[model samples]
Target: MTTMPRYLLSVFGPAARTDYGPYPSKEDMLQAFADTGAFNDRLQREGYFVFADGLEPATTATTVDGQGESPVLTDGPYLETKEHIGGFWVIEAPDLDVALALAADGSKACRGVIEVRPFQTAESVAALLDS
Candidate 1:
């Protein structure tokens, strides 16, 4: 039997998509959330979904580095951009083709671009099993 390859599904949506605006009407904001929620529900139905999460706006983010006791903690994003990584998922599939398909599906669900990268180990399978 062959083991399936695992992949990282990095989902990037419109930076302000989650903002939903400070709508004048409460109903307007509610409707926007409904649409996003429905999309998330669909992803749950798909077997390709291994895990999923959303991120807070990059506005409040701070960069950090170095050791814990004296780690360098910087304000603002390390790299400024209109968009951030947003969220991601870890999925196991048969091959690159399948992974890409899943990524496309995720993009549709997230209403943005989804990049899929196959996870690889520097050592061969035999080497891992022997260790």
Candidate 2:
């Protein structure tokens, strides 16, 4: 017997997609939100969704590093880049092909790139420890 592996789909893109300006129209924003919601519904109905969400803008983030007793905090992202993660999803799939297929849809829904990564299971960790 086999168990399906859990995967994470990390969505990345610019804060906004505007070729001529800094923001999209209110109607376009609402439409995108609605489309994303409908896409999430499809994932849930298909049993592929475990969890998913969009994140607040990167400007509201704080980065922390170092030891717990004396951790350092920074005001911005760890790396300065044109693109940042806007959202993510946790899903279960039998293999990479299936996961990528789902990720493709996710990319279309969010109008961004999706990075697919498989989660490490406890069984694999235990086996590694015993080795």
Candidate 3:
């Protein structure tokens, strides 16, 4: 049997950092977590779950760039955006349509925008690095 390809579902929401955006209330936060856990359980039962997690606020982020002996390290995210990725999930799906369906559930579960994209294969990553 052919295996399904993996896809990444990125969840974006208002930044939790008070310096950046309005943070959700404690009740809402707990509810979101509960909903997400149920969703994850469903995905697991369906054999679609790979890995998933919620992330800390962007203020805790450090950006490292520069392709040299000593890479450049900077504070904050690489992009200045209104919304930041609050969480992510790696899932196996048969096609983009299935991935999109899963992303819809993820959106509801996480109470955020869910962006789905396919994972690049090892060969593709090697080619990109070489180029």
Clash count, one per candidate: 0, 0, 0
Residue 25 accuracy (lDDT) in model 2:
68
Give the lDDT of residue 70 in candidate 3: 93
Each model's RMSD to truth, in Å? 5.1, 3.3, 3.5
Model 2 local distance difference test score: 0.82
Model 2 Cα shift for residue 117 (angstroms): 0.8
Residue runs of model 2 more than 4 Å from their true location after superposition: 1-3, 15-23, 123-131
lDDT of 3 at 9: 97
Model 1 over residues 45-92: C-alpha lDDT tens digits? Answer: 755556667666666689989767788989877887666777777877
* lDDT top scorer: 3
Ranking, lDDT, top scorer first: 3, 2, 1
TM-score of 3: 0.84
**Every candidate's lDDT:** 0.67, 0.82, 0.86
**Residue clash pairs of candidate 3:** none
Candidate 2 per-residue lDDT, tens place, 1-131, comes to 86689999998878555642222666666666777798899889988889998887677799999878899999978888888888899998888999999899877776678899989899879989999
Quote the positional error of residue 96 for candidate 2 in Å. 1.2
